[model samples]
Target chain A: MTQPAISPALPADWRDFFALTKPRVMSLVIFTGLCGLLAAPGSLHPVLAFTAILCIAVGAGGAAALNQWWEADLDAGMKRTAQRPLPAGRMDRESARDFGFGLSGAAVAIMGLAIGWLPAAILALSIFYYSWIYTVWLKPRTPQNIVIGGGAGAFPPLIGWVAVTGDITLMPVLLFLIIFMWTPPHFWALALFVKTDYAKVGIPMMPVVAGEKSTRRQILAYTVLLVPLSVVPWFIGGTGMIYGVSALVLGGVFIVLSTEVGLRSSVPDDAMKPEKRLFAFSILYLFILFAMLVADRFATIYGWQA
Target chain B: MIDDPRTHDLELFRARQKSRNRVLGSILGALAVLFFAISIVKISNQSHKKAEAAAAMAGQH
Candidate 1:
């Protein structure tokens, strides 16, 4: 815990604090949550809907802050994470911890009061899952951290659905599963290219614990499972052709890219193109998939070709 | 309280944190008030609609 090397007087700017929120990751959380709310059968008050998304964002930020707080020591050793506010010694650990708790507590309280309790309850659980279960327990100990911990990221849409419907249903659950299955491959793609970082930091990422060959095989396997699972919503009439077709096409590309990643033996610096492409496309694939869901719903409402 | 020299810096940190918390607390308080006002307006609007419907029924009678 003693980072004796960092100068005590180094000033922390507001951006350093903002960096703790993991804004890029929160964007996907917000998008998915919004899609869930919009795709639901009923309408919500716009104010309440905004509040729900805000809560999700704040909860995610808090979880990320806590994750950094706990892993500050581990992060300092890794080049990828060394510049994080905590690891960089731009912010004090106590402040980071307190900030995490404050944001999480406020988000949950506002959610329970302004919206419904179920979503708030799930939001709390999601934060706990990420900070405690994944960051604290699984990440240091096991190679399968993201596989099980992906539930933390999967909860936003489910929470958003519950916020609208005030209960669990099959559709939101399927959306959850879609993201859940998608996580391993998406993360493993990044992990494959960044294996050395994990190895250096002594984190048991799949690529570090298992060989790259095994990691690539698992990535392909998850992508294969994810493709069919993503289409389940359309098959069950939960979504329309817009989402169905988009998912099928996007999934085809995902399979092709992942297959290439799996089959390749040599990953030269310049030739790691497949992994890079997969990582980049995975983000787009999810964003487009969710966007199509919302578009499909609107199309159905207006009696347009969906 | 025993004045331990080692905790002097921590005491200042806590004081700073307390003031920051107070500011955040005030913002949350304002938000709670806004939500309360919204709820009240919604309830009043519903009741006003009910009263108008009742008056219309009475006139028909």
Candidate 2:
């Protein structure tokens, strides 16, 4: 149990407020959401398209701010999170809460009025799901927090598709599932190395509660599911050869990397080469997969491939 | 509130936050006005085009 610190003089700067948004995470969310919008069959007015992407980004940032606010005390215990505005005592808790709610409310309202209500509703749900469901309800209680909480992150692409097409479809649902299944392996890899941080904070991450063997097995299992799920869009003729080939190669590499992580045992922190490699490659895998999806759409539109 | 010695820092922080909120509120207010104007222009443009097309059809008839 980490007690809150008291420091009176250090006021939070603008950068601290920006950091509350988790800009790095927001980047991936924005990219995937943009890809989903591009890959959809129909088109939207340029202004409306921009509005949708902005809403997704702002909503993501708001959720991140709320997550940090809720975890400020727990974060004070972890080395990686102690420097955050709230934990560092540079900003008040009420400030973060009010800022987060303000951004989230504005984003949802703009999305609903400018684009469509469906996407706006999903965006609102994503923020609530991350801030309340994952952070408050699940993280402290269960080792399966990442699994259930994965739905929160997966909403971006689904919302993007709805923004473009005005409804849900098999394609958007598949995109949602792809991210959903991908989250466990992605986060578990990070949890493997940061197991101590989670344990110290009393957060029931898989590695802390279930032991390393179970965590590794679960990681590999998710990777196995994700590999097939990733290839389904291509198999269903939703994407062309370029996307199909990229998914196959990326999925194969993901499996190989995950296998290495699972098979290795008791590697030292300084020598955690395989786990580090898997974690790095997983991010690249998603980026390239989504990029290729958009590239494949352009290829079709340009008559570059049949 | 700032006169309370025990809570001076807290009151100062609250005042800063309120000022920031006021700035943000003004920006949002401006943006809402802009969006409303754009919507009105778009709607009028669409109506104008519809009237022109209707006139063209009636002339042919």
Candidate 2 ranges with C-alpha deviation above 4 Å: A1-12, A268-270, B1-61
Q: What TM-score does candidate 1 reach?
A: 0.85
Per-residue CA lDDT of model 2 for A1-306, tens digit only, reads 522244255345556788899999999999999999999988876667777898999999999999998899999999999998999898999889987998899889989988889899999999999999999999899999999999998999899989999999899999999999999999999998888998998999999899988998899999999988988998999889999899999999999999988876765555677877899998999899999999999999999988
- Candidate 1 lDDT, tens digit per residue, A165-200? 999999999999999999999999998778888888
Specify the CAPRI tier of model 2.
Answer: incorrect
Worst 10 residues of 1 chain A by lDDT: A2-11
* Candidate 2 clash pair list: none
Q: For candidate 2, what's the TM-score of chain A, rounded to 2 decimals?
A: 0.95
- Two-chain complex of model 2, DockQ on C-alpha atoms against the true structure: 0.15
User: Once superposed on the true structure, which residue ranges of model 1 sit more than 4 Å away at CA?
Assistant: A1-12, A267-270, B1-61
Model 2 chain A worst lDDT run, 10 consecutive residues: A2-11
How many angstroms is residue A246 displaced in model 1 relative to the true structure, after the best TM-score fit?
1.2
Q: What is the TM-score of chain A alone in each candidate?
A: 0.95, 0.95
lDDT of 1 by residue, B3-55 (tens): 75435545555565676566668877977876876587557757988999999
